[model samples]
Each structure stands twice: as C-alpha cells, then as structure tokens.
Target: MEPLLTAHNNEATSIAQLTAAQQKLYQWDKTIAAKHLYLIENKDTPYERLTTLKKHLAPLDATRQRDLIARYKALQTPPRGRRVEEWLRSWVEITNMCIAADVPETMGSRAQEDFLVACRTINPEYGTSGLRDLIDLEDAGTAIPSVEDYVSKFTTYLKRVLPLSTGLSSMAAELDVSKPQQQNKDGNKNGNKTKPQCPCGLKHY
Candidate 1:
C-alpha cells in the first residue's frame, strides 16, 4: 500500500510540473512555427527572415535589442552545466559571439572587467586568474561599472526587450549541469586522500 501510494503521489507531482512546463513549451513552439509558416506562406527568403527579425527588433531600445539577439542566439547554442563556472562560460561565449557578429556593443569593452569587479566585490578570494584571458580585454583601461551596475542595467534592458517575443518569455530557466566537479581516478568519490587544491584555491573533500 505504501509503495502504491508513493507511486501515485509521484505521478501527481510529475503531472503538475509537466503540465506547466508543457504549456510554456507549447506556446514557444507555436510562436516559432507561426513565424516559419508566415515566411513560407509569403515566399520569403532567408534574407527576408533576417530582415523581418531585425525590423521587429528595431523599435526596441538598443540594450533590449541586444538582449533579444542574445536570446535568439542562445536558442542556437543551448547551455550545458550545473556550476556558476558553466554559466559564466556560456555567458562569455554568447557575449563574445555577439561582439564578433557585430550585433551591438551594449556591454562595451569593460564587460569582463565589470564582472571581475563584481566578483571581487562579492568575495575577495573570488580572485580567479585567467578570467582576463577568457574574455578579450583590448580596452580595459576604460572606467567600466561594477557587476551590480551591469546587472541593474541588464535587467532593465531585458524588461524592455522581453515584450518583443511572440510568446517567448523574456526570461528562461536554464538547467545547470556544467558546474565543475572533482572526481577520483576510478570514478569513485574523492576518498580519504588529500586531493590537490583547484586552481581557484578551493579544496575538495
């Protein structure tokens, strides 16, 4: 009886979450499909598709447009990882791509600098080297704002841009599976040995 009740409870929980998630996913899928259908029905070319996206996005403020473009790009390259590092890596990649693609210089050259400032502000030991290397810092001397400032501005940007999506929410909840992990040689737990410290100086158990 206990096992049967547990199964029923689990099924109920799964159904509730799945229903909510599926509703959102279905809306997203329908929006994308409708865009494609319109293009096909109108016999629009790929250039037309890009033009439509650009025109649809043009009325938005510059920062908001940049955020929308980032979301569009993220649809192409979904993130993977569970750690903060994973999120950072994905952000760096996306930001760099946007920069390279000449989307718009919303973050400016001091984005990495700003992030470092935020990290330091949050925790001095957050001093992880190579962050500079990870991001291109050709112009670091400029006075970039702190991470908090960037987040505030970015949030404002997102709020302005989020309304552009046909059904896509301005916010997305990404699953984190890419956080860094320490594993033993044979895939066992870190065991009783005193493992070496990570480059970030964090000791593993």
Candidate 2:
C-alpha cells in the first residue's frame, strides 16, 4: 500500500498533519492526485501506483523553486556521473506533471513546454517528431504514457541528453537567471551592497 493510505488515521489527522512526502505526492497536482487516488482505491498494480507519484516539483514560486533546485543539486550522492542523469530524469518526470497542464495558472504552461524543449535541445539526436509526440501527450494531460510503450524510449532519450557537469552547470545558470533574487531584511534584493575593491576583482564599492 502507498504511504498515503497509511499516512495517518483519516479522522485523527487533518490535512495539515500529512508528512512532506505525502503532501507532495498527494497535493502537488490535482490531475495526478485524482488518477493516483483512483488507482489506489481500486488496487492497481505497483508500477501504476509508483509512476503516478511525482515528487520534488521545484515549487511554483521563484524563491522556493531556487531553494529546492539548489538544495537538490547540493545534496546529491556520489556527485558525478550518474548524478546528472538522476537529476534530469527527475525534471523530466516533474515537468510531465506541469506539462499535464494540471499546475496552477500561477505556475503557467510555458515553463512546462520550455522544459520539454530544453530536453530536446540537449539531445538533437532524439529527433523532432519523437519529442513532439511527447509534447502532444502532455498537451492532453496524459503525459504519463503507458510504461511498456514509452518508458524505455524515454529513458534512452534522457540518457542521451547531457553530461552531469554540463547539465548541472546549465540548469544552475538557468535557475539563477530565472529565480527571484534573495532579499535581505532591509528589503534589498541580493543584499545589493558594495565593498571597497582593489584590482583584486573584489565587489565594486
């Protein structure tokens, strides 16, 4: 059974009492939740259940997005080769939820579309039509394709996308550009401060 079913006694635990993983798995996307809840209620196969549970969504707010993205990158294990693959694969899945167009309007669809395009951009070898088909699925809110039909190809597609170091650097740079700047208590963005500088390339004063 999924953690959700066993999360807590329904009557005793308010929605607020669910764990972080439970909240993310069950509350992140309504479309996803509906599908998964049905499968759980009907005793669907484990594969069906697992695939529907999307996690670490990078959130909608730019500030939260940046924090989570950075933390995910920072906390990765064996931080080298396979690390990058794992990260991109996760984004592919996470973006699929957004692509399902189930995200809040505040989150918008552009980011999801842009993300799929990005995966394609990293791997021109994936072929345009193949990428387009995936986009089409996302367009129809069926981004989670049948496991046997698309999972293998999708795995291969992502496997060929980008190297860990390259993907990490690129993703980080993109997040840095897009995420809202960190603000100080003084209401300064990124602590907009200057320091006395020598030709040592210190911050400008």
Best by lDDT: 2
TM-score of 2: 0.27
Global lDDT scores for all candidate models: 0.43, 0.45
Q: Model 1, residue 169: displacement in angstroms?
A: 28
**Which tens-of-lDDT digit does each residue in 8-122 have in candidate 2?**
3364345576666556544433345443455444424444455544322333355554544554333222133324446555554544543344444214444434344444543
Candidate 2 regions exceeding 4 Å error are 1-83, 92-112, 134-152, 158-205
Root-mean-square deviation (CA) per prediction: 22.7, 19.6
lDDT of 1 by residue, 139-202 (tens): 4454544434444443344345444422222222231122335656554354565457899888
Clashing residue pairs found in predicted model 1? 81-176, 81-177, 81-178, 82-176, 82-177, 82-178, 82-179, 83-179
